[model samples]
Target: MTDSATSVFEADLPTLDYGLTDPPQQIYPQFRAAQQAAPVALGPIGPEILSYEMARTVLRDPRFVIPPGIHLSAHGITSGPLWDRVTRSILNMEGDEHRRLRGLVSRAFTPRATARMHDTIGTVINELIDDATARRSCEFVGDIARPYPIPIICALLGAPREEWQQFSRWAEDIFKIVSFDCDLAAEEPVVLAAWDEFDAYIDTMIAQRRRQLTDDLLSELIRIEDSGDRLNAAEVRMLAFSILLAGTDTTRSQLAASMQVLCEHPEQWALLRDQPELAMRAVEETMRHSPSMCSTVRSAGQDITLGELTFPAGTFIVVNTYAANRDATVYDDPERFDITRAAPPPILTFGGGVHYCLGANLARLELSEALKILAARVPDARCVGEVPWKPLLGLSGPVRLPMELCR
Candidate 1:
């Protein structure tokens, strides 16, 4: 790891306090200021890498590796039994271990498999919309966004249908550890308890799968083999933990944020309603405009020089993807939310290189299908009340998006 003291760009940059409930729009100015100042500068938490090119380079660069478990513990977050397994899972892994795990999981989580979920995803969207429409005015997050991804992920994992809500709560609790803006010491106890319960749930599910094999992602993962090597029970449990944690609230946040964007910009909504072909493009635009996960943490594994900045191993770096995606140098009128925006460079919302999100394909499919369904069914829908923002720095989206549907 790069030592922070030796980094060339170690000058103190302006600090911005990110409240868990602060809206993304409120936080953009600070990122823009940092981007204009330097490619890499000190953030309130640590060093920040700002700018699309620099962030992309760092993500793809082998020198910038995922921070180890000790780094997280230093932030006042101690791990539980399940939390320990997940931190050592593929998400935090590096080099050969990451490659092997990624390969094994890819067999079960393929693009083709994601494509097959399109019909099911569409069905879920319509059902949620139907329920919202019947109410005329409903809290969009609770009614649609929150419930939408739960069953889909549960079915994919082969977990019991009744347990989706339980998984959702656990996933939500676990995500608190990732929020740089939150009170980690205060939230630690709840997070630990949630992990214990989640671990027990996953253990029981794994034992059941062992007894009677089912046809789901979990079963496939358990049976998946790479060069005659199979995942152990602990690895399988962690993978399930990863999928549930990565797939649920993150997808829900993205969906809610995209919906909020469309509601705010009715003109864009009208364009999508008229030309449904723009659904996928709109999803891309929303991701670029308001990414669910704004930033990621990395540490320099060895001495490295990026741009004018040089750092020794052990330096902490924050890749500000939110700022990067909206870089003026990369996009014209970078702040505008235009669905018809022409083919631009790929956004860093899903990240880049080896550590890129494994569920990117599935996420894109869900967002595209979600927008298409919304355009077709609720063209006149509009936000009706104060949309509450979740108080988390790592990911930002509305907690309750109240909306009045077309009667």
Candidate 2:
């Protein structure tokens, strides 16, 4: 085993800048270089410093644990009142606790259940695109992708439609604070305010639902019973925060990126239009091309050996999904954006193993529905101006994707 003093370990990750001009290309080379030089290395730079990985060792290794405190500290978030609620999330849990909570939440995300939302999801997409058609030109992110997630999530959570925009505002800021690339110093106030507001709003909603339960996920979760036990208020709050944060920003970013890619690759756009049946394929391809999450970190649970290097317990493991998906060894001409490229293996856009994203099905539904509607309505839509892509660490893709709908 390699000793911590002189092992080929790398640290200094938080400060690593893959420059935002064209981040995908900029970061891909660095990740590929890291994979070759040392699968694990010091993070680029930052506090709570640790190592990062760019290989399949993450799946084979069993030493990595998802301890919430370690993960938060890695991002420079110190122990505080806010950290308590933040760490209670499923993403931070492991062992029995993780499995137990994940089981209950998994029920809401099963493929069969998500399939039931197709019609409603399609309706939202059609309405948004229809409105865009009338406008002729709009910022695809703000107008369509951004607004679409609210109604879908609101319906799922039993939140009222009248409060959609308010929730959207809260959801946006709340997720931003937690994202890897967030400027914690600047966004702390906004995030705290958003959480306070979300908590107050949810308390009112929960009280109302208790008085009159409905078919929404929130109401349903309230009534869910397992082994003669039900979820408490704190658990409900954590679940609500997870769903809103997980469901909204990722979906919005993916949808906007899909449109941006389609606009860039008109030939592929023509193919999608010609074969509307390939909407699912298009969604997967878009995810491969422009993933929402750039990376996820796991801590070594024990001394583990992989390749020629050994990771000590408590080491950080970084999985670069964007780089992994684009690895030339994994896919032919990985740089090309081909929706109809002979069915490819499931991409890591949603993740893999026990911690795969719970909202995968919902995201697929939203993307499929969005593309189906957009392709049918504005098949000739094109980029109208410069788009702004956010350099969020954990969350990524375009922030402002302006486009002009075909006349």
Candidate 3:
């Protein structure tokens, strides 16, 4: 932590309004103000926690658990039967159930499994880049970013290639339910319908897999055992849905955001072009600088006190990962986009502790390969239009990125 950064924490903190619709850059000032004031700030939803140390403590502490279903219901957002089933999967589980399910699925995402897909991922990236750059001027999100991740995940799960597009649409609709400023009342019906469709699709796939199992992540998940226990049909369906939900749009948005960042910083692009091994470093910096998922919501399992605030059991806690990643106390000139910065401690872009993102290795593999391929194939690519930002609460990224590729 720098001296100037130390001074920031010493200043009197200001009460800040947590706005869902404001762009992250616009909202960061308030985040800095709140972090300086205290570890946690009272917001409309409940208490919001900033600062790296406090945020990590809240995430790892068992006292802060997954939000209760009723709490989410109060917000007028329901996951319907399918998502309800998914919630029953690892995402909302705790204690023994979470441990069992996570252990079973952990094998599928091990580093070795993820590494085996390197050539496959590179091939997919090249194909997408070929199609995207063939036009010279392209909408990067729709052409490259959006289409890339879905099939890779589908291939990993043994999902039929023909249905990838439909699954992608379903994932997008399901995500709207979780967006910060979403009007739950208006979007609830559509979200429910999408879940129903997704549930039916997954059910059929599960049945098919049972009849003739394949060598894929989904099949492995179905048969995976922990202490001689296996996931049931509903559990398998839910796990598959959870994987699709977490893997698809988030990776797409992150890739798009990273590309936009590189296009804006041509020198960084040149750096990567000159030294391809820095691709992974660039991905990490992009994740640190402009993470797709910004904040995560958790409920206090019991009364807890930390840094001048006492959160009662059931109190809603929002962990501001974006703020923590940019805290100057932790990073020198934290806001500047620098890929060469000394490797700092892991950022909270992926939640830590028991709930650390299960697909993190897969995400890293996809991100690094995406950067490497782009640096090699589209070295001269440049942003061509005003990038439209996605107005989402828990996640941040570009929704539309137009780029011109010079061959």
Candidate 4:
């Protein structure tokens, strides 16, 4: 561990600008340099959490809460469909309301619950690979990464399989909010308009589900809504919306990211091809190295102390998860992308604590299944061209991955 006595570790140490907007080539080294210093340092926002322990502490601490609309509101977006949609979503909620929403849908996302999608996820992967295998070369993001997760999520929601394309387009556009590269203000109207279209779409689905009362999650939600104590119409819609946003966007970005990392490491790629059971390990390594959600911010609700630092209420600690995941104290040879790295200390990619990603099990199951299937099917898959990457400051992944799947 680095010394805390240094000026670089000063509590007031000027914002540790990791030069987020710069290319990742420049940004990652900056993170590495900072990790050599003390764990806690001030970032452009507040204190950027660097160490895995510190990050874990901050993320799990009860005093820190994610303030709703802090992302868009910081840029002067206060209200509208975009604001209402985000602020009302289950992801941004807190207290009993948050607890209640989570409780209602918790069973639906458990490991056992998500594992039900394993076969469907594999089937989707095979169909997707079959398409790419025929082309030999395909823009991985568009052809595979972008569209692959939609069907599984759709199946969960009990929606028609054909509706996957429409849902994908809407989810992709709506997902731009999580990426720093997206100009939210410029995208607000467009995103809100899509929300309106989605608003109608989901309403129709809910109505149909209400009438037919299928075994789908949506119908279950309707039953809960009608039960009077469990949920209401708005809550039902919001819960479903939260699942859609969290499920589709993160999985899409992460699958592309997983592929991007595997393609970069030919040896690891081949290793995975030979041992498909390593799919879980490979996905973990990919997430540790190339996470989709770049960082998550937690706002302190009161004064707090961690080791040598104190943060006043309202102070925000941004968990640079990508950096913290590589914290040298926890991971051996942290910089190396090795799927076989034994006992990786629970990668902070999906985060920790109560707000830990609701779709984590599903995401992992999806990625693991995808990795094994792809490795087995396209044994020679590799990055054939430069990847147009998303900003490392937000949801990061290849916007376009030129991949050649040589069988």
The best candidate in terms of lDDT: 1
53-161: candidate 3 lDDT, tens digit per residue: 8899988987788874533475664666534654565778889888778888897778987786687688889999888778877898889888898888877877777
Q: Model 4 — TM-score against the truth?
A: 0.90
Model 2: per-residue lDDT, tens digit, 1-407? 65443333553222345443345645665666654443344544321111123344474344566657543564577777557767777767777877777777776666886776677788788888778889898889888988888888877787766878888789878876556665765676788889989988887778888899976777766777778767777677788888887788788888888889988999888888888888899999988877766666677788766655566777666666776776666678877899997967668767666778888888888888788778878889899778777663556788798898985
Compose the digit string of candidate 1's lDDT tens values, residues 282-373: 99999999777788888889878864467677878888888889999999999899999999889998888889999999999999999988
Pitting candidate 2 against candidate 4, the one with the higher TM-score is 4
How would you order the candidates by lDDT, starting with the best?
Answer: 1, 3, 4, 2
Stretches > 4 Å off in candidate 1: 1-6, 10-22, 69-75, 78-83, 172-176, 179-214
Show model 2 residue runs off by greater than 4 Å: 2-6, 10-22, 32-62, 67-76, 179-190, 207-212
Select the stronger candidate by lDDT from 1 and 3. 1
- Distance from true location, Cα of 291 in model 2, Å: 1.4
TM-score of 1: 0.87
Candidate 4: tens digits of C-alpha lDDT, residues 195-283: 66777787888888767988667776766532355666666677777787778868888899888888788899899999888999998
For each candidate, give its TM-score against the true structure.
0.87, 0.86, 0.88, 0.90
Clashes of 4: 0
> How well does model 1 score by local distance difference test?
0.81
State the weakest 10-residue window (summed lDDT) of model 4.
Answer: 1-10
